[model samples]
Target chain A: MLRVVKPRNARSKRALDAREPKEIEDARIAIFVKGTHTGEVVNNVMKDLMALKRPDAISFSKKNVIHPFDESSPTSGSSSIQSLEFWSAKNDASLFAIGQSTKKRPNGLTFVRMYDGKVLDMVEVGIENFVSMNDIKSAKSTPGHKPLMHFASELFDTHPRFIQLKSMLMSFFNGEEVESICLAGIEHVISVSCAPTPVTLNTASTSADTATSLPKVYIRAYTTKLLSSGTRIPRVELVNMGPSIDLVLRRHRDPDSEMLKQAMRRPKLKKTDVEKGLGKKRKNFEVDEMGDLRGRVHVGKQDLDKLQTRKMKGLKGGAFDGETEEERPTKRIKTS
Target chain B: MDVSSILASHNAKYQLVTVEKETPIEVDAGFLTVTDANSIDEDTFNSNIEEHLQSLARDGVQTLLAKLFSLPTLPSSDGPLAQLPPPTTQLPRSKPLPKIKPLTKWEQFAKAKGIQKKRKDKKVWDEEGQEWVNRWGKDGKNKQVEVQWATEIKLHAAEDHDPRKAARDARKARVVKNEKQRFANTAWAQRAVEAREQRKTEIQRTLAQSRLSTASMGNFDKKLEGEKKLRGIKRKFEPTERSVEQEAKASLALLSRMESDSKKMRKNPTSEKSVLNVRKAVRFASKGEGGVALGRKTAGEKSKKGGKK
Candidate 1:
């Protein structure tokens, strides 16, 4: 549950307004929390991740000894969930990554996403191989620059788990929502590709065993090289920038359908959006690829008598030279 | 031309596929890293530093790749993919820790009184409705008093007394008071910051005044390193070079403005007239002797005797 925050002054009011639900949302802030017994590998992995999520990231230095996924009783994790919810409200953050390691699950990292100060979903992953950025001698992207995400697998679109992971990674790395992107601002690319699924797990039916049998996901970071192509579009190349990691899927909690629907709910279309043809489609009207508003007009049969035409000296008065003005034909000349 | 001789020649020409070292390379499959513990060969290093370093880096990468290829491979469209082991290396944090926020007045009081903050549910159970309803927002329990149809009236109440309006007004006043308290809390929390800024501005004003008080207006004063130059108000003037017609138009506009200002000043003619009557004052000082007599008495009888003679 979120505590109601009443603003005291104009500055505080403006700050609160910024955190309110907006038609166009601001960049989501992510808070990184450390578990009580995080090993060296988990710590390093978290550090590398925090480096990538800089500027819009908050890292909690203190260790929190709470299990978010206690299997005994669902209410057992309520205290931990409450603390996480408290931090979410206090910092106005919606995303969280908890790093914890133990004998059962070594080097485990959990990504917890929140909706309205409540846990929406949690995905736990074990870090397999990690090469930090310091290990590789290459150029790095600017801290705040948004990286272009490239998912090179059909599983990301087809598999349910991969789909959730893809969406989570997208939102995690997503910076400010922009109307347009400058080509030069794209300094790096994050490529995530998974190993082929085992033959036994390829079937449509998914079971608990299939979760462990899921293929490992490889994440690679590369700095983009824009070369002159003698055109407006540049020829791009990818150079390996380190912090490359391989992750094995572990435990996950799927969001409830009703909650998911509420979380995905969007504000109603404004009058301006309706006017811009972005709302309900109107018949016989279309916004073209060039963003021009085009409409098809169906006019009723027009009377030629009332139709005005240009009066030229040659076409005026009469059809023949000897014809009188009153006796002339009243038929209107149709212009092609 | 023998097969053994040909194989030996080919092996000599190509570099060894496996790296040979005094101490075996330590490979951390978890971190995907390899550390070469073998000491540097001074003979090869002294020959060329760049080549030696390149060779070292190459060996490290080669060992790491070999370790990576040894892992369990999963068939993929691109190629066989190996699942990396868990990382073992430790890395330092990239940023400093976040600073703790200053406590508000209410928080300080709560702490002193040892009051534990309790979490309240956003939704409250409605008895009449037999369902949970929002505590405050849209169709909330707070608005139930005003929205309810039935109401109680006191015996001395007026005919036009509206209980709903009174309740709504009281709610609005409470909201206003709450907002005021919130503002007070914010102001109290920022007291130190505001006081520091005020002191800085006061010091700056005093310094500016003292600097201008010098005989040379601090113009010839020795400047300290990194000291900023004080800037005064900038005055803008019309350009000296202009067309004759434009200059004449500007002058005419100025003349009209001055004429209107004078007209406004001359509106009070009576106030402009002096209250002291010069003629009356002169008569009183001279005892009503008239101007000619008064002048002769003051100048003595020299001028009159000279005229009589």
Candidate 2:
């Protein structure tokens, strides 16, 4: 799971390094997709979870805080809170986002923040009214469904669904574990008592074809503006960040090409950059008889004498001379 | 010029060359000078020389007497009291006498008191032992056993000095020895014993804990795949007539299904649904759209196309 921290200085524009910031040391969150889910659903959820990597939103020292899925198993054997804690301890993750699918709620995504393997707070975001790639007959037929169908929303504040999703996600920080809220189609929408707004996004009845509803549900998670106070509550807030859909799901003829393009987005260390100033020849290194570092000119008389003897032997052995003449005449000469 | 003059010039040149070179200082005085001076003049030299026989005989007899006198006193020499004449005259020895001596009186006294002077007083009082002891070497044979300062340990004669002693000593040193070797008091001894008992109990407790931990681990004696417990080899091959009939029925059903599928395919070689399905599949397979009718068709169009054909 990609965990991002807020940058400390807003104006500083230096490129990020590989090392994770110490500030985010205690804020790492492990993401797990339930092993029981189908491969396609798990893959989709994982892509969405990784999309939450917004190092710019958080003061993270690392350019990429999220380790790739290949680093650890995406599907854990057990989804129990205790087992999750064990996994978190093993991965050194302070928080965990578990994705589980059930008969009632097929696309359930839960975000939980922890401290020393103890659950500090938790929020469950139900993915609804979103069109999966499977629902569209042919991606090549329509261009509008390409970006809309796949979750790649760069504009969070302007997008209405994004705003609602962010507010709902931030509501989890008001207190500890909250009761699972029930909506028309959603079986649960977790929220604390002191939430900024009501858990139900809309008071009106949800339409039958909620899939075509305005402001689609994009499930992107990110660190939010934490409330700074004298109280004892957790200071960090994990807000729903941005675009929670696979980048390649919009590809027409081939999804693999899109995946490759997405994979290549990572910042690489160019060979030219690495070998820029290493063109000059280095001076010959020498060590003294006492094992101290000294220039070649500082070699003592004894060492010089030994070297001279070796040089003389080398000269006598025809080391410096060209290849020696053959000792024996060839059989052809004997026949002649 | 004569040949001698040429040789003289050559000799002169050789001398000059030798002088120029750095010849060793000691070599000339060591070997060359003696040989050059002793070269005999054979032209004017006396060949026969016989003189002073009487004086030579007397010098020889005097040297023989001196040698006999220098001989060690032998047990059987008492019978030979061969009297020798004293020297006719005393020979004076060479000396560069000192004007005055710088020898101290103390040095003179130390030199006068030799080992013979010390040996004169054999029986002296040993202050530390509070007894009179004969300080002579021979007197040691009669000295008391403990009083003897240089006593040999006789380690080689001891029974423990066998070849196995080294290995046994090593093992003994490694064994958990008594901690009370320092203080023999009862309180310290009790404390040492208690410490040993405590260590023993700690080791036993750790062993027990390890065993219990192993016991608490999951027991994985699961059944192997396709395993039939206690079934003999004979039972594995026991052919039942029922499975044969079941196999024949299954094969017959598969054959009938294949025949029906082939017949239906032959009848609907150009069905409208199949054409539409093929069209939809091809449209899905097509690359990025360029005014192509990709997947937006309906059953009406398919039927119309079929009618036209």
Candidate 3:
């Protein structure tokens, strides 16, 4: 249960108001938690991740024993979930990363996404390889700068698991939304690609059989360099910025369909969107390929006899008079 | 055979059973993905980019849908649902590995001595009870002396000395010593980290100073490979495009903040006492005799020169 906080003054009231849900939501805040026994690898991973998520990230120095996925006992897991919910409400954070390492599963990191102060889903992965920024010896993107994400696998769009992972990563790295951004503001790119699937696996294998045969995912960060080009758009080059990591997927819990639907619910479109023809379609009017709104008009058949036409001196008497005017060539015979 | 050709033409018209491409699409049904590795047609791409992109997207989606349909599905309330297999791509860890902790004194010594730690069982054998019991808790062997009905004493022990009390005190002392050692270990690690940070700052300061030691302020110095340029503090100011009304409001708010900050600073009891500055008066008076001399004069001790006069 979340403790209710009543603001005592205007300043406190204003601070509370900042955390209230809005039509356009504020950037997500993430809380990095340390487990009861985080080894060196997990600890460093959390630190680096916190660095990337700075300004919107809060880290707990104390170790917490949270069994988020303990299926053996419902009570134990729910207790951990309650603690996470409590933290979420207190800190106004919806995303969390818990780093826990043990003898059985060493160097493990879990990402927990919360919806309405409840755990939505969790994905745990093991750190197979890591290269910190210090080793790269290159310029790093300014802190708080939004990174451009590139997912190079088609599975990200088609597979449920990959789709969830993609969305999680998108929200994790996304900063404040802006209507427009300067080209120079794009400083870095984070590319996530999958290793090619092995040839031995049969294409007709069931989902359960293929679950354990997934390929490794590689995450690479690169600083973008925009150089002058002959055209208006610049030629861009990617320079390797460190913290390159290889991770192996371990365990994941999918959200219920009802809960997922609730989580994905969006606010009503703003007036500006409706004005720009982005809202629901109207009868007989459509936005064409060029984004221009086009409308169809229906009119009754017209009477040609009653239709008004432009008056002309040449056709004053009709076709017979115009022919007589052309046949009167004797006036020009003397000049010839 | 004639009927088969007509059926084939009808099937092609109704359903896009096949997509013709110079390079065949690669499908990974397990992941439900399709990769069209074929190069773009330059003529079509240049002539109409939208049409070309739409065609490419169409092919890709068709291939993906074909692969998705081939997968096994289970009947559900919503319809026949195709389950997605777990993602195979291994992603990079979001963070770097944690730094190793500084070894404690005991650990350092053990490492140097090549001592391997052996695991000890929590339960110990009790000779009298002929059963295994906890070594520490719940009728543990460690508390045997304190819980015993009778205990032996040394021959030279004091008359008032209770063996149980002595044993309990000894156990408590051991716990306190262990706790103190633990504190010392943490303190040592903290000091090591602080010292390292201090050293780093000191080195940076010295380097900064030495760089400015040259006549040209090290601007003309020989550059080293992969050396980073010195960076100065970056200055930021409010946008100049703001309206005058907004600018005035902002300035007023800043002024109020400054006024409040000064008021808070002056809230100290000593500073709030009086307007008269006693330190300034002391400096002004006594012909520059200083505060100590003035205090002596007030205490009825005459100066040497005053006494001579």
Candidate 4:
């Protein structure tokens, strides 16, 4: 017999089922920059994006791309979803940074991250505060240091969603399902398969004597959902977890500081393999180890003398050379 | 409509018809082919006659028009008198038309003689009175007279004294005579003497070094040179960029010293002292009035200078 099913009342709270943490899928983040900005602005923003230096991050194309954010525009592929799926399958990059610019904010750069064909997080950084490289040069910023975009992480620490976004990137980097906000100063203190990791100070306890210890590094986990607040479409946001750690890692450096100077120093260029193999001495009439005559030709003394005494003009075995010419006495007549 | 009918309807209506009339004329004046005389009614022809006559009468040309137009005569007592009889009254032809006689005998005599009357003189003599009287008695003076008198009182000169000047003189005298004032004034002299001695010693040391360059001499000069190198005081005046904090400290010190000196002397703060106080207060405020924690100073300065690496 079919039993009658009762409707669950909205007032009654449902129990949360204990399920395993969602596994993080390892994928390269494809950076797609689309804007009407000049080459310099685009390049500066790309530098900032690349400065993240996550192992799985790669630009979707070469710098200065003008991809359309509007999916309906022609040449946006047959369908946006199909194109994204195709690119993701081909590049193994389900994550993407869609940088866009609009008329409302001309000097603004917006970075939209997509995970599995859906938008995960977005960050809009305005470039109004950025000083030009020429200005930095004129101001005598330390030698060997080229003024580059350095994001001030402290400015975003107050923002509630920054950490969540940071953790999302981190999870993509490590490819592990982070259940809790487990973090330590530049050290991996927990794993997804392990039992609840015990928290410990990696360097030293927080005290006056240990003030010189390395600063703490933060790890956060994010869960995104469409938070409806009366609009027809809901705003996608990461759920906020209250303040956990006071670790303010110096994410941005002074554009003119000594550390930046060292970072901007170019690697010393050494001679190439071919130049090294060819020694300083001029190899005349000598063959290289590969049996190739790679140097100037040597001239012998006898050859030099013969070439010096060689006659420029005068017929050989002629009247001038003691051989008499035979006389042609009779005129030849035409034969029929 | 057909084309011929349309054209006939729009064509000018001109039909030549001969008129037979017996009149007292050798030949009849032929009318033009486009004459509008027959088309005009008798009422239309005479419509403007009355209006023209009324207009001519309104312009005082009615009699002249009556003769010209040969209009029917009317009775003298009717709408208008006939043009055959002219109006009766004529303007007087007398050389001197009747006019009011001049009131004065002289004016009357002037008119009788036909000589143009002289305009009444602005100034007229009173013949009855032997003396000539002014036409108007004492017309108000045209220009104003500004009368001034010397009323300054000559008083004896009083003693002149300014308290600030007196104080300055007293201070000068004290500095010249009083021991404390002498001591304060002597400070500059002492500084000058010390500076001269130092400069003399420096010159002597340099001279000795120059002389010793020829041969081995005093070893003490070597120690002096080493001390100078260690101190890094090569010149009396050396310019160094002062940090904000150090400048504030120096200003505060100068103001405090000025404050102490004025207090010890029991004098009111002068303009210079007040100016110094303002400067000191500003510096104190910039130093945060001890509200900023000691540890945060470096951090705040670094942030202001563009955040740390």
| Model 2 misplaced regions, further than 4 Å | A1-27, A54-79, A129-336, B1-309
Ranking by lDDT: 1, 3, 2, 4
Please identify model 4 stretches exceeding 4 Å from their true place.
Answer: A1-38, A62-71, A74-82, A117-124, A131-336, B1-309
Candidate 1 or 2, higher lDDT?
1
lDDT of 3 by residue, B96-132 (tens): 2234579999999999999988889999999999999
Clash totals, every prediction: 3, 10, 15, 0
Summarize candidate 2's per-residue lDDT along A130-186 as a digit string, tens digits: 333344333121111101011112222333334333332332211111111111111
Say what the interface RMSD of candidate 1 is: 17.9
Best by the lDDT measure: 1
Candidate 4 per-residue lDDT over residues A260-316, each given as its tens digit: 233223323224423344334444545567766566766756764334332325644
Model 2: DockQ vs. true structure: 0.00
Model 4: clashing residue pairs? none
Cα shift from native, residue A86, model 4 (Å): 3.2
For residues B1-309, write the lDDT of model 1, one tens digit per residue.
569997776564333334566777666554333445554455665686434444554454444444554566666665565564433432111111223357877789999999999999999999999999999878988898899998898989998999999889999999999999888877876896789899999999999888888899999998889988897889999898999999999999988987785657567566666799878887987899877778878777777788899
Shift of residue B207 alpha carbon in model 2, Å: 48
TM-scores of chain A across the candidates, in order, are 0.80, 0.30, 0.81, 0.32
Interface RMSD (Å), every candidate: 17.9, 64.1, 16.6, 61.0
lDDT of each: 0.71, 0.35, 0.69, 0.35
Summarize candidate 3's per-residue lDDT along A1-336 as a digit string, tens digits.
Answer: 766789999899999877766644556889999978898778877887777777889999999888677743353545787888899888989889999887878788989888777888888888888877777789988888766555545556555666677667766875234333333455776656555543433254444534467656666666766554432334455677757777777788887667767666554666546546555766787667776667899888989867665566866677665565565586677678
